[model samples]
Target: MNLFAEIRALVIQNLEAMQSEGVLPDGLDLGNVTVEPPRDAAHGDMATNAAMVLAKPAGLKPRDIADALAGRLVADDRIVSADVAGPGFLNLRLAPVVWQGVVGDVLAAGTGFGRSDMGQGRKVNVEYVSANPTGPLHVGHTRGAVFGDALASLLDFAGHKVTREYYINDGGAQVDVLARSVYLRYLEAHGQEVAFPDGTYPGDYLIDVGQALKDKVGDTYVGQDEDVWLEDIRNFSTDAMMDLIRSDLKSLGVEMDVFYSEKSLYGTGLIEAAIEDLKSKGLIYEGVLEPPKGKKPEDWEPREQTLFRSTEHGDDVDRPVMKSDGAWTYFAPDIAYHYDKVQRGFDALIDVFGADHGGYVKRMKAAVSALSGGTVPLDIKLCQLVKLYKNGEPFKMSKRAGTFVTLRDVVDQVGPDVTRFVMLTRKNDASLDFDFDKAVEQSRENPVFYVQYAHARVNSVLRKAADAGIDTNATPDLALLDHPAELALAGKLAEWPRLVETAARSNEPHRVAFYLYELAGDFHGLWNKGNDETTLRFIQEDDHAGSVAKIALARAVAIVIAAGLGILGVTPADEMR
Candidate 1:
């Protein structure tokens, strides 16, 4: 059903034939050969670099190879013409029937039209939005959550066995701060006035957690010291915060398959086990690190610490696993967590981190490399900051979150679909400006609206045809779809399968949003063309067969858009309000 793949196979078959006929050399590496859309539509429908890629290897002139290949390519019924462009690039114009067939294929496949098997069922673990379970998620974590969830969906569509995971940062000092904050709230719930110190959380969200604790214990821990209540409250508060986070994610349509607890790695010997695995490979040692660059020797006090030889596995320097006080460093638990992932037998690991964690990438990669013995590949994607603007100024922070806007604030303002689509309109590493006014705007300038309008327009066409009593269920005569605009849309639809494969290979889910925008543009372009020419309209008056064929084409476009939006975790719009 992938026309480009079928055409490429044809080209390869013809090349093999040429080799047998001695028209070309016996062997030429064709791995780099590629077929894609021509840079300019004026050139041709599709373009191939096969001639250019093989010319030097075969010891033949570029034009000479192109000429021979063009003749063999035209012999197929699909390709009508193959013309050589500058320096042996072959531009191909497929027959109208070939483009027409793509519409029928889309109709038959529905939303599954672009699903690919490129991953070949390899197990991939995508860990994202591993924010500290101290409070509800913020705007930064929102971007990471959407990016990771969409990536998991994209991998699944591309045939990978994906596990959506969230790592709870409950083992760190942050949770202790949260427990103390809740304890103050608990005192307030017991009719005691309390002032939150600088180090504790002051958000009103904890007020309920305090009251709930009172409801459960009923004055059991009243006026107790930190030693008696800290442990119990830490566990209790973490569970409450996680519940809030889960509810926030569900509101945004993100659900994780696993919520990994960082506390489990502690007191479980997992950290020691992970470090021992590194020790067995001679990667662990005790040494004093050199003073950081630009630091005067007199100002630096170097301490001997237990370190991992991360430099051997591509990190900039060796990393310390244990602090001078003998407590595990922050990086130790992270290493153990990733080692556990590798031990779970995943073929690949992907971590979605906030932009501030860019410096931590190399060390984490080194840890996974050493733990998996270079077997599992780790790809870390860092999502940059999101700047919110509204009413010609910066958006106000959420009072509930205390310091930043919560994910629920964004979702509540412009439902989940718009929030998800607008978040992905930019690349993960690039900073994004999420303007409240512009996100819900109904104009071509807004990409989410533009794409959704296209789907809604198609539904309108089907509804109108149904009301007119046109038998759309009848087999569509695809041959009647011979207009230039109709064929152009079909050509765009043909690119879907290839687009999915490329996006999945690069681990970029934003490309799906980009492609949906382009597809919508093509569809809207054709829809507008019907205004100038009566014959170009999708529903031809009194011509049932002709209308059915064109309606079939429009339906096909909607199918692919829904499929693309589905991968992005946005529900496709059936009607625009």
Candidate 2:
């Protein structure tokens, strides 16, 4: 299954054998030892730094340990040769059957072949796309939604119990602005025409909310003062906007396990309890912070306020939790929200925030650390902006969101699969350019298209094999799959499990997209290679056993591709349109 792991275990076993036989000293730390794919495939199948890692600690030369280790590794049936390269790296060439066996294992395991247990069932909460319930979700939230959903799926694939959460920003002044905007729309839905003033949402999306409000209550609150309708409309507009947001996310194949409201934290003693918990730890105090770095002294004046001792936990400076006006700052609700998450007993927490919120990461982490006493770790991943391109020009804004492209616009344009795949083509912290022209192209230049085409080609081969009456259900003569090209394809298949473990451990789901692309490239390369060599074709008229062997390898590639796409929330393509 995992040949690399199997070989590494062999290396460790032989090292222990060496120690017990008095060939080496006792109790050396083997934690740093690692076996991975060689940098250049032409050199070997796998390379380990066992010698380099142990040389200094064991008081021995790297070459000496490497040579001794190589001697023992060659005796294993799976290892064809083990040679020391560079100062101490052990380069290994595995037996042909070792790679062949990967195909059999994949067929037996099906699409679950590469699923890993690396997470050990740890509880992780992933909060993402917590955009304020003001209007529709935009392109930036789309990137966060795709990235966070894929990351949660990746963690789940690796054996973590993940909860997808959305924190509603309902307690902020923005919601009040939304209510004011919707009230104007309500007036517009009546006989009177209303103009949207500044500080109010003017997008066309709110017109329907206004119309719906008018439908529910006909002109009762139309002529009322702010006090008569602000609170009621605030609740009404937020619910409507959240319904719109939920529809947008569902369009992109994203769903949240929880939708926590900031309004619930207000006047409910939750914020007080959290701050009190921090106060008990001496983390809260009333103090005046010095002028922030790089700010003109006159630009920022000293003001006495309630501050959190974030500096004690790793923040650059103590952050104020309450303003001089005796009102809680925006950071207070966030701290309380995270405190609630910690009390829920999660092993870890991950927040996917926009890149503009990068400044908030350290302080948020500090709050979680102080509140949880460092028992729970909080990781905030900042997603950079997304730029849309069409016809060699920047795309226009959505009239619905006003000055931004909505998530519904993207999903409607490219469908969820292209939207999700293209969103993850870049790293979360890096800016992404979603080009309408490039995303749907049926060429290798487009990664999603290329990967999907590979899956489709594999399906084509299966259909062809079945039509030829080649007994597609027969067991493959895996040993017959010894051609260099065939074995290379299998070698790529063997990396799937390891890739899943590494990508999940790093919390980078983009790695899954990248790996799927590379696997597709390998599969495509083998498919093209079959054109010139009749023997390399997956379906052979003369040799049914040989055809079965090659079909096995092709099917394995498709299985891995589908599994990888599943983690990305992308549907595998059986045919390209």
Candidate 3:
């Protein structure tokens, strides 16, 4: 149960009571009222700005409203004391039993303790790692993949019908380059020496695709001209690259519900249909764009083109849909793709893009806005670069990937768990430094290790209790968990449900990682505290009931950590090696 929400409801109930009792005026909008954890735990268990927000509205003094509200709040059995702090902030400290209830709640709910229904089953499409199907995914795409996959999981936990999607950039020039590169490899497989030109991919990963093509066709297209092989090879190479990408993602524990082909939008009349939808709304026009800022008029050759009135829907300027040569511009297919998403009847849309695509955000949003007639909202999250370091120096690039580190390169080095956790240790928009040495380090400084150790420690406690013949399955007397350290951990556990809704509302899954770290800190803090205080030790030598209750509290922490880690797509460690 969400104690914060329950307390907020109590505060609202008391405020309405005060209004009826003439302590405050009627009809004050209580929407601004909020009950949250106090900034300082020393202040109280929860703090509310109800008095401060309603004071001016009710034509009453802040302290006067707070005093009246405090008296009414203490009448509830949960709240033991309500003290007014600076101005009109009311800090309420709940009874020990209230915090103790949190442990029992966590044990009962298990990993589902923090799952929320905030999204209310809304259909959401989260499109991420839509990298060009040219080669295996790189480090940049790795961050996007983890962020998007974790976000999809977080949304699902928060009660959204999330669709994990990967939009294949197979219809672009990049795929053509890949086809040519594979063609060169195909010639090499046919015993012909070939040199990769500057425009084609030179990665050794393509050597196998070339050899596979040779195996399939038996050099049928080895000496053929581009006209005969380009189309067939382009399709073949895209399928191969996508297969490699899928394998890379699967290795990292990321699986997409849909792998949408960009080629489907081309030749299927979808682009024209999407543009026509815009045209019907008067958002399409043929016009010459103004020369870009800082460009001299003589240096700029303005071309009249078919444009989408993106400026009407929050973009900086109108965008061209088709070029002067009458070929669809690069953005035309993206518009069609998003239009198709809207037509699929998703209540909301989320796109996880790499940081370089920051400029595309406004225009893509504008397209969805125009296509959905402002009905479906689009949220674009841009994941910044991930810098790899090892042994205090920059990590070397993958030879297989040619010039950059591939996702498999990172996952193979640290395994998927560490890779996933370390990737999310930073915010999506913030640049992350993934140090190979630091990621696997067994220290409090490493969040992944710290959080995992907490889970393993709990498991260790359970195992020790089991060996000692302690009946942990018996109903835990939560009331015995009255120590300050025990209560502090329960207090942290109580924040999970609230934190889940907050993170899902903002579309940030890194917050889950952050919260798990804090929870682990609280747990480890209590575990350490047991060293100096014999009464605080979880496994009481002579008291089975006491040990069971404390172990229950420790088990509760593991439950929430596993739940939080589950949302992050990282498996919890039963024992850290």
Top candidate when judged by lDDT against the true structure: 1
Query: In candidate 1, which residue ranges exceed 4 Å CA deviation?
Result: 296-299
lDDT of 3 by residue, 17-69 (tens): 88898888888999999999999999999999998999898998999999999
C-alpha lDDT of residue 41 in model 2 = 94
lDDT per residue (tens digit) for residues 140-235 in model 2: 999999999999999999999999999999998999999999999998888788887878889999999999999998889967999999999999
Q: Residue 303 of candidate 1: its Cα lDDT?
A: 94
C-alpha lDDT score of every prediction, in listed order: 0.94, 0.92, 0.94
What TM-score fits each model?
Answer: 0.98, 0.98, 0.98
Q: Please, what are the lDDT tens digits per residue for candidate 1 over residues 399-436?
A: 99899999999999999999999999999999999999
lDDT (Cα) of model 3: 0.94
Residue 557 of candidate 3: its Cα lDDT?
93
Clashes of 3: 0
The RMSD of every model to the true structure, in order and in angstroms, is: 1.3, 1.2, 1.2
Clashing residue pairs in candidate 1 are: none
